[model samples]
Target: MQKTRLSASGAGLLALGLLAGLSAPAFAQEQAMDKLKSMRVSGIDPNLPLIPQTGKNADAIKENLKRVKMPAGFAIDLYAIVPDARHMAVAPSTNMLFVGTRKSSVWAVTNRNSGDAATEVKQFAPSLKFTQPNGVCWTKDGFLIVAEHNRILSFPAAEFFYEGADVAVSEVVPQGKLIPVEDESYNHGARVCRVGKDGMLYVALGQPFNVPPREKLKAFTEQGIGGIIRLDPFTGAKREVYASGIRNSVGIEFNPKNNDLWFTDNQTDGMGDEIPSGEINRATKKGQFFGYPYIQGKTRITEYGYDKDPVPANTTNPEVYTEAHAADLGLTFYTGDKFPAKYRGGIFSAQHGSWNRTTPIGARILFTSLKADGSADKTEVFADGWLDPKTRQYRGRPVDVANLPDGSILVSDDFAGAIYRITYTGI
Candidate 1:
């Protein structure tokens, strides 16, 4: 069946004359083709189908938005219905929003008119099936990079080409190459990525364990299993581990003002619901390690017997601590003009609510005010009411936050399967 599809795809490309100027890669295509279990291509696939944009699920999400709350003069509205939306990338050239999901699909969202919500949402490159493609980010020049469980792919001119089934696509990290095969697991596999000021693509790979076992420490460190790694997106080389000792980081953003890297790390579990707090860390320099198996938010993990092997002398602690088990995921610096002056250059993060606390705590948006030195002065709830106080049930769970060019911000909800636009219209 795979061979048949390849033949047809090749025929389709020939018929459309897309192969006229195609050039071979420095690496052999046959060598990489052997590694891909799914389809491989660098051309268009006209047979791909479009996902329906409107349905009952979208309507239900709209109704749930009625109960959502924000600060004074700020309103939340449904931007688009993107099922299983986990991370987002807003295009620099076209303002198109590409959303990723925990499952197989990546959606391209667009706002056709000014001062309105996104009207179109469709599957991106329907011919390819992505595994846990939860991280999406765009380069300054317009390449859309999607980070999956163990692979990364780049789409050139993604903003303009995404309207069709096939956009020019190529591999950054081929399947079975991002991590060692022995370490791959279903848990903690969602990846998030961002393009830094230096133009390197930084991707976070979460180690798949509640507490990273002591036996795997050496191997994990070498492979960046529990850390963030940066690579040249164009050639996928010049790769190096950027930060280490992070257990699971689903959200990462570079401070636009200083180019400092910030990420939210989910800490150890089963150590009481409130002992180890979730961490928001700042990486001012490369090679900085945040405690994981050795220490979690100042509380050392006695289980690993780190007393014999003391924690690293240069281990950097978290910049801020969030409520234990609150599950802080996506984060971004508020660098938009739509909000009031007080919010300029502040931080906005999404807490995706706890799964197994005695009582749930986080289905809301958090705001952190920064002091002159760029340190966090205070953190407060910017938006809430996603969790029903009376029932303790979640109406929506925000996974990631992205900013629109007009100064409005977008919140993606995997539970509600929608992207919501938050705009501040002062009274």
Candidate 2:
């Protein structure tokens, strides 16, 4: 049963940061309502044009999908046309998906028929303006939390009421408090978040630099920069650093079996093509550090005098290492039964490919099989052909991977501005 105090008559009175199974006192609930009332949209026009769902642009995306190659029994098709799609959150109780963008908009996509494609796609909360709202997550109790470049907001009951322009909203982390204004950067600022099984919100904050100077390390660690932080979803209280020494992590997920936190960190640049490797790290407990500036994926960072500094004794290295400059971004653990047995409890990660490699690689999806102890056993490419081998051009760069209700998976491509659903047919 749902643990919220929401009643049939007072459903609209839902407040912000309402983590599931946590009960608030009467005064606390009233205070939340008061705060919710003050969170109003300002300075943004509500009648902004919605993205075109069906057009010549969408047909171009569909044409590109025909070139994408997966396993023999699997097929991929266009699911929706979302501009600047960065990350996605699939609603648990509603047939809707909230997609975030690096621009000023979040999109609401409706799959009313449970068909192969979305029927309606529109801007969510047209009345508000978002700044690089690239991170989105949904709670089991019906709240949609959007983590922007420098702020975080929560919408209560956003799944059911997103069709309207106005939705009840509150601030999970107010603007300028996510990070200092001076520390915000155009690069490495895309935040990603997930709700943990313990009813806390875990957010990854990327440090904005190729390699941060040693003088900034103390301040960054104190502020949870270049690390993952967990906080109380209700009222944004009890904020604490969960993990440290991460360079710039854009993908994070909690393992379903043991609830261990796993993430993908993009390593430092300008270190040649094949030196420091991008990392897939696992944090089994809080306060764990993953060796960022001193070491990246078992390679000591010599640039910016990082190698001169002494490494911490408690620093934990990455569990799995991918090729350098592969730009591994989003990942998810497959817990569904529709796929073959080999993929049941493994992980699917998207490598956005490289930017300035001598020869480009990794515009595809990769899978990692796990051992009984939850350690990574083997890693291999699961899908490719997104990058043309001869031309070295990317047809689509995959960003994030998500699961559909039917046990299939959805992959978001920002380059193609579309989401593709991949399903197994058992041939």
Index of the highest-lDDT prediction: 2
Superposed Cα deviation of residue 232, candidate 1 (Å): 0.8
lDDT of each: 0.85, 0.86
lDDT of 2 by residue, 1-427 (tens): 8686668556644433353225444444444445444764433455656667788998988887888877778888889888777799999986779999888889998898888998778898766668899999976687899999998889988888776666788888887899999999998989999999998999999999888877899999998999999887657889999999999999999999999999999978888899688899999999898898899977889887778878879999788999999999999998778899999889999999999799997889999999999999999898887888888898899999998878899999888888888999887
Off by over 4 Å in 2: 1-50
lDDT of 1 by residue, 245-295 (tens): 899999999999998899999867787878688889899888999977788
TM-score of each: 0.88, 0.89
lDDT at 157, model 2: 87
Clashes of each: 0, 0
